[model samples]
Target: MKRSIAQLKEWFRRGKYPTESQFRDWLESYVHKDETVPVSQVEDLPRLLNGKFSTSRGESVEREAAALRLKFDRHKEDADDEFEKIENNRQALVAEDERQQGEIDAQQAQINTATGQLETVRKLLHSGASWTTVKAAFDVLGGNYSSLWALANTVKTFLEASDTSDATINRWQELESFLQGITDTDSLTGLLETMKQEIGTAYLNDLRKTADELSGIPATYAELVERRARGGMLPGTLYRITDYETMVANDPEARSAGHPFDVVVMALDEHTLSERAWAMHSARDAAGYFGKSKLEAWQVWYCLDNDDTRFQWADTTRGKGVIYRLIDEWGNDCPYDFKNVQFKRCNTTGDFVDNVVDDADWPNTHYILSPSMNGQADMTADETDYKWLYTFTYLEQMQDVRDASLINEVNADFESAYYNKACNCNEMQAYYIGEFIDDTTFATQALNNIVLSSYDEENGAAVKMYGNKWGAGCFNMTFHEHCYGNSFGVNCYCLIGFKLYYNTFGNDCDGNTFGNGCWYNTFGNSCGGNTFGNDFYRNTFGNSCVGNTFGNYFQYNTFGNSCNGNTFGNYFRYNTFGNECYNNTFGNGCNYNTFGNDCDGNTFGNYFWYNTFGNECYNNTFGNDCDSNTFGNSCGGNTFGNYLQYITAGEGVKYLNVTGGSDVKHFVQNAHILNGTSGKDSKNLLTVGLPEMSTVCRYVGQNTAGVLKIWVPADLV
Candidate 1:
């Protein structure tokens, strides 16, 4: 009934096993009936069952099974040892990783602490700490001496680079001195306190003085009124009284004796008065300050209107007596007596007369009224009246009144009328005569409002005379001449001239002549002239020269504004706007160069050189030579020179003609012929005839003409 080992082996190969009930019954009945046997040993039961069914040659079934078990156990033991070793190694790696992470965290914490300390030290260094504090901290930290010195230098550099005041610099210098010494923190602190105290004390002292310095003088109205009323008179000081009422009240004896009060106030001291008080008092006392005799007739009326006590004497009197003594001396009637009469003064003689006086009666004097006295007349005079009747209404009108006797009489009359005898008699006479009258021939000549006149072979010629404004005249042999009102050529023959309103050659022309509004600036007997506008702005030599001529015999030279003249030349003739000709002749046998508005004339020869704009040229004759000239607006002249260059004129072929010897380049809008010739040979002529495009022509000598011309297209070449 038991299964053989061979049958069992067959069953195992064929994937067949015994039934659980059969196996259990067999184990209970034959192997062992003990339930204490471990079920883990059941795994070996199958191999034992296989061994029992096997046929071994030298061993039993039980021994074979046991040997197989021992081999399996050894393999299991080796795998377990390998797994244990792997687990131990994994645990050891995990501990090492944890330790490394702890070390990293501690290192990071130390670095953070160092960074915080460094930041703290930076703040202390930037805060302008004293040398004592820095040294103490350095010593405590055991810092290297070199590193501490470097840090101190760096801080010093930083502070110096910053915007430090003078006081801060001084404080830093003191700190440096202390650091050089063996000073402690306590000593440094004491020194700093002392410096602060001294600075504050000095600042307070400056502030007090500044307050006092800024304060100005303060005045009162009561003091001003008292000073004005007193007329600057001191107590018991004698003074004149012109007012009849005041004379009657203050000096009854003078009033009864038909005299004005000329006595002291007997109360206040004028010397003790304030400066402002004295000024106000002096202003009010017109008779004493301005002198009673020097007062004009109009001044008398003005004083009366202002309630001046000096003029009050006239108010108390009647008829002719009512007029102020100043008016009587001026040869003028009272304003109330002759309301219709126009009071006029002789500008040459200073004599007052009625407007009804004939012009011929005052031929020797300028019978004109000042602008201030013109208000006395009912109506203003016309030009004719200004010449004949009211001759000297303006200061310029007296320029040609050259009668010495008349001038003396006029001066005397003015002195008597205004009580103002001139301190310098010669100056007064010069003012009246206008020029030094050594010759008597100019005593009768008087030009009145004539625009142009020529006086030849006359001893004394008064070109602009008797209220001639805006007139021009010339004198040839006259010794004394006078011009007025933007006129030219006054006071010829060794007499000084006066010019006004941009007038050229207005006074004293020995051998020079200039036009109206032309500058008479000559050097070495040469005619260097300039024209100006309404504002009289001149063109300078080197800047914006319009029309100026230099050198001798410069004729018809027209420079635009302030053009410079020739330096050395005899005949710079017929130059129209030719400025700054250096030993050059312009025009036809005339040394002149015509430069356009704001152009310079640096021409060197007697040739007709006309430049429109800023053109610079050297010595060359014949056709219009515009070399290195920049044409801004239009170029309409014949240009020929060594290197005649033109730029931006017109877009066609008719405006500019640029003919030069060599290297003649033109970028103009339209050019007629760009002729670049080296010599007098047709073979060396480079002419570009491209009317539609701008061309650059050069002498290449490739062709028979020895020239190369490149034509660039209008759009692109």
Candidate 2:
């Protein structure tokens, strides 16, 4: 099987074939099993066949074998190389296929999310055609719609452009407007599709993107509100996004001024934009705490039913900034901002009524809080107030300051009010005379239920106009009952004061003192001689004259309001003159019986009690009834801001007589003492009414501070 070349090569390397003929026989034997049984070996054999052995060299046979071996090795190498190349190509193709598949998968995910969101938007839009509903749905989109619309408009503008002019851009815009004009819900889709066909896929894609964006943005608006809401957007205001190009195209002046012409705010909701008209209005911050609390935040303001329609806002134009105030009714601590607060007027309805809301014409809702209060008040903004606003319609404006250095001359304003003459005068007096429209009725209620100097509404503010000594002396008040609003006393007895520390004559915040020109705070007093305090106390079930809501401090005074003689447990401190006794000798606690009304000018020996404990000897003479005619916890407020207070040991604190100048060393404020009662740990109380801690001084000679150290004669005891 060896070729001639192979046989020749083999014969050249080998000295000789064992025999030329043998070589031929061997080559012939190997030819079938191996190729390249060389022609060289065959030629040698033919030489041997033609003539003698000398004709052919054995080298030919050796060359033939070597050639055969080389051919076999080259063939094996080629086959191995081809196999490796094929395997590498297969692996590369598999990798490329997998990568392409991953890209396709990502696109599939995008489509899924988009489909879900589009479905949600569709559901919201289908709910209603009302602005409220649409605005609610728009909140779900956050604000992405604005961006999308901007992008689409930009494209439309570019598309409308011609090579030389803006003709193409204008055409694209006109097509958009035409599409917007399709009002019939059933035909909207068809028209959009038609427009899509005209504007092409590029523009439609942009529009879809914009709508989708608007459907996904979060809501944001008004600042300065309480922050807490977390629902999707509450309500969305409609904003007209003006295209800058069109605005500039229409108004060259505005464009040149660099004034904003795009994105105008309007009062109408999204559903109202069939034509472009804008009206800016202010709104409460819906996203604030009120949004989160839902109903609780709405309970703070008082209401004025549509009863009194006398006055109106200073301005009557809508959409202008305005400020208004809510005032406490008449019986309210007049000038004292009695729960009244100022606010911006953001809403109103109906036509303006140039009438005044006075008590005579107050609406039915005009009412006053009951004197008996225990817990929180009711929460109903819809309730009709006993009163109404002077007027109910108007708008406001803001004054811009062009120069900071210019001094603005503004008059300082004070609130005031007058009440019915049937009431005794309150220490402080002021008035408010804005259109009573509704406050009049509320004012009447406030004055009606108040408790002043024994002046009951049934009896009047007072029958006689007492001179100087009348904390209840304001009987024939010159001011008309419904005349104005201010603090002339008689109403909410517990007058609130705005007195700053520097105010020597004004009712300030640093607590009122005697002779400082401030009035007393009677939570609610209607007349002189009025003695019942329904709101001052309370039991565990929340009922009493002066509820626990207030404290017990009768500091710097010697008597309370309304002494028609039915008062008890009331306290007194600095001021004097209402009791009947000028001098008392016998201890008064157990000595007095009935007082007040007809018992005045009574006298007794110095040994009798002048004011046992307000009714006996603590501060006055005598002339009050004895139901509980003594000062105690249920009578006054916690004492502070003054000296001398708390002078007893039984319930509130331990007290010492020290009447005979007998025991000054053992009767001071804040001194714990031993109880007279047996078997009880009697040293927990501290007395409060003297110059120092005399309780400690009582045991200066020994470590027995709280021990009972004073003993009086049997008669004195």
Candidate 3:
């Protein structure tokens, strides 16, 4: 034994690269030396070699897979085209009896193939064979079977038992519901983990117990792995009752070995064994981390999963973030790495080495192993065996050519505008710096040349859509203040000076949340500014504007916005000629507004009492002197703090507003009680006189439900 060891060392020092058979002979000799080394050292030889050598489980697997893949190439290729043709024929009679029967036959054939392959997986896993033997089966598993599932515990690794399965969907449903009741389902990531743990602990155990109660299904060596030696029970293959992390204390998943070496893998195009293995690589790439395991310096071997020639873009080769994994499936290699490029590599350079030996039939292959160009005869390099083992491209690099089948080569008009470009640019997604359609007509018109709204075709009843081009889902997606078009145009929204429109600028002018045409959320220059607009919200959700108004005018059916939750108690003044605001919602009550001064062009002459607008009138301050105008010109939501003045119909008043801050809720609570004044004031669009509520009530007001306390005795202090 010592002499043989010296000879082997001498050979290494001589730089004489031994052939595989020679190396195998030397290894066998060494193992038996001294009788071979000690029993303990003999057992440790494989690990010692694996730890020190560049050759890894992956490399071995690639060599074997490349060889095995050839035997199944022809059958797999035929299957690939057949499936592709079937998939492409959208109107094919796949649903008909004969065609369906044919599909069934094909699918059954594959299923049988998969079943045959499963035996290999079990045989390899049980024997603790190299990953090459194990993955050779998976590479072709999907292509060989109609189903995409892998039940390694089934007969010969195929779906034979039928399990005639006792489905526990209802039980699963109940368990999910139970977990949801106790868990914060809102935290998706956390909840998923919790669900995984809970399901394994409870429902899965129950199912297993039921199986045991029923004398269990057929058992295998895989089943033995499913149970712990201790009293604890566990699921098959993947999980354990005691977390491996907790048990090992040592982290076995640290992969900081440096960048992985590329390896080519061979497999049938239609979910061939190598293809399945490649998919596993992709899955691993996506799963950057696994529980506490750090995946680093990982190489992958992906092959054509669909067709030998055709490749579908999977994604990037490297990931730079943390991804979670709870299992060490495939012994901690990347799970699914079916990069399309890997397929191309195999097809181009790989010789269909169906097995270690070439055969005529596309019968069984060992695994996706390939012949190394410069290596010993009949030997394949590990790196040249699979897909993910090769370089992967970035998404940005492939952006131009990705899925370009529908690309039409049409010439763009030199000086014409298209509908897709109507809104500044086609995409209004976040971070885009283009000029948006929703904005004030005063400023935006100077910046952007195109106008969103248009002049009305008919009597031009304020062509609401205005110059704005209509998009499929662009209703109410406007910003009045940001609109740079002609503000004085007949169709321009609100008063000329004030640019008021829903989504007035950008996509945030946002008045469409309410009922149709209800534009109270429409603010002039302030983007998200309205009396009750853009306030603080509750968590992710916001309070809805339901019932509200400074005066009795903002109701649901009659007005545009909701006036339900106004904090100001019935104080509908200082609106300075805003109109038809039905459905306006106040978070509380509407109060303290000076509904006294510029109540111009209002449909009704109503006023709220006490604070400012409410300070003067107790009943509903109905101001009507000039019989000149209607709705938008009506005097509404005025302030009494500013001295009462005569505002012409259609004119707006700003004196009623405060620059820094105003005590909007000086008088009432429970703002819902203040919802009274009707929007029925059409007669005197002008103020009758500058008389106080004391004098007006005596001569000019109606005896409706106790005047001051008539509508709401609750709001009056």
Candidate 4:
């Protein structure tokens, strides 16, 4: 049987060479044994049998074989042509694949280069390099001019807010100028170097200044006392009564009496005591008891003695004389009232007694009466000359005496209008000038401003301003309004707003913190903690949101904003709404729901979790555990979960849409009806076959009111 040409073509197409036995059978049929063909013709026989050939009658055997040979040659030529075309096509395909792969590799290389450049720029920015240096580096790496310009502006703003030093300000100015005039990369590099040097030096100076400012000053007297008690030295010296006694004992005349004297001494430092002694000695001649000539040695004592020993001086020579009577041991007093009494060298033996006369007939003129002891004697007679005589003793004896004279004098000085105006006096100086009893000038200032008030130094009346600006650690703050605690608003002006905590404000605004802006009808907005927003009309949590704009009537929402008409219930967290959402209502615990622009009129019930709805999806209802439900654009009247419909069927009947619409309704098994809507009487109601028809037959249908009604069988009822 002759094989078909279709079989040969199929074999050639499949690249299947014929078996040797099959090729031999076709060769024998083509050539007769009697007529021996050439060896070349026989070798070509197998090639002839492998291709298409024809066997026709009424021709010689050779002619017929030759015709068949010609046909087989044409088939073999066609097969070679087909093979060549297929090989060429395959090569072309391979080349095209290589070309695509090369393009992809090139794109990947470019992406990697871009990523590396971005990382380099980020590292440079965080390396504390100046903005100019970073910009220059970016330019060297072929960064765009607009990005460099933006970076420069950002750096300028950051530096201005963070650093207030003259060097920083000057460097920023220079950098701004350099950026504006930048024409070449070389100039930019030079500018970057200069800016880096300036910033580095300024940073060092800032550190130094911070260290100095943080090293606080010792301001209180208690601190000085504590330091001295610990055997530590203070910046200034403190004097005690024993120091004064030691100085008096060192004097030869004061020690020669051989008996202890009762003395009340104001023991100040040597410099201060010397200044007071000179002022007192220069005014001693003007004292009433002293003669026209200056005393060889004048000692002024403020006698804190008992009433029995104290005596008052009587007026004698108009302005120049005062006399105190000397009583003897027998109670006999001196004659002439001891007129113009002056202490000469006493003839007595005791330390203090040797300073007085023993004889009653001698005018008893030896000791100088303390101005405090003598009523008629002027203590400030010389430049109110004896003002220290009264003030120094008053300050020393203040602790023992109730309503001490020093307290009245100091309070009087503080109450004076000229107290702050005198010289360039600070608050402490204006109040404490009277307390410096060693200085006569301040004593005069204190005495002139004396006022009779019930307030004493221990009470609130003696409060004085000590420092500038109110803070958590300041003292003596003035002009503070609505302030609390010791240091709040110490030196601040008009701090009258409410709910402040260690924060300073430049202007007034209620219920906001740290940030400065005007809020009109906003509430519960905390601008502290780096969350900043301002100028909200009637939105709650407006300033509390981070980088968001809340329009009017936006309430009970947080996090992302630009929510114009979205009405949210309480407990909404991390929800973001675009500007196109209008009249969208969210229930409690509705979190992580992102509504795109134009998503309007969507009502979400409680616990609507993890849903992402597209834009323009209006009138969509969502319920709890309705997880991963997505709505397309313009999709409306859609109900998700079985919470929105009524169903009372067998176990398999899960979802039913009573109100028919083109929208898709999605629900899970075991879902039941929530609140249903009014619809047709008997729409597409689905039921499932049960195992057995028990006495109970439940069916879901619409009642006369067109609401969903579940009916029960009579036996089950």
Best by lDDT: 4
In model 2, state the lDDT of residue 301: 17
Per-residue alpha-carbon lDDT of candidate 3 for residues 271-381, written as tens digits (9 for 90 to 100): 222221111211323333232222223333332112111111111222211111111221221122211112111111123232211321211111122222222222343
After superposition on all C-alphas, the RMSD of every candidate to the true structure, in Å, is: 37.7, 25.0, 39.3, 44.7
For candidate 1, lDDT tens digit of each residue in 1-717? 355555545545656677775565444443234445665556677676667444564468678889999999999999999999999999999999999999999879755655445544554434546645655554544433443344445554544566588987887887565355424443444443443444345446656665633331122323323544667534543222223111111111112112121111122365332211111122344444223332222222211121113322222332122222112232322221111111223232221122222222433223332222232213232223332211111122245422121121223233342222111111000011122234422322121211111111132221222222221232211111223323233333211122212233333333322212223332222222332111111222232331232333333444433344433233444444433433323432333234444333233323223333323332223232232232332222223333333332221112122343333243222232223222222233223322222354322112356444333334353
TM-score of 4: 0.18
Predictions in order: lDDT: 0.32, 0.27, 0.27, 0.33
What would the per-residue lDDT of candidate 2 be over residues 5-120, giving only the tens digit for each residue? 45656664657655677567556656546566665656567675678554356678778889998998999899899999999999998999999999999878755654556544
Worst lDDT run of 10 residues, candidate 1, spans: 423-432
- TM-score of candidate 2 versus the correct structure, residues matched by position: 0.20
In angstroms, how far off is 700's CA in candidate 3?
1.1
- TM-scores of all predicted structures: 0.23, 0.20, 0.18, 0.18
Model 1 lDDT, residue 199, Cα = 36
Name model 2 segments beyond 4 Å from true.
1-385, 389-717
1 versus 2: better lDDT goes to: 1
Please identify model 4 stretches exceeding 4 Å from their true place.
1-562, 641-717
Clash count for candidate 4 is: 10
**TM-score, candidate number 1:** 0.23
With candidate 1 superimposed using the best TM-score fit, by how many Å does residue 432's alpha carbon deviate from the native? 24
lDDT of 3 at 37: 57
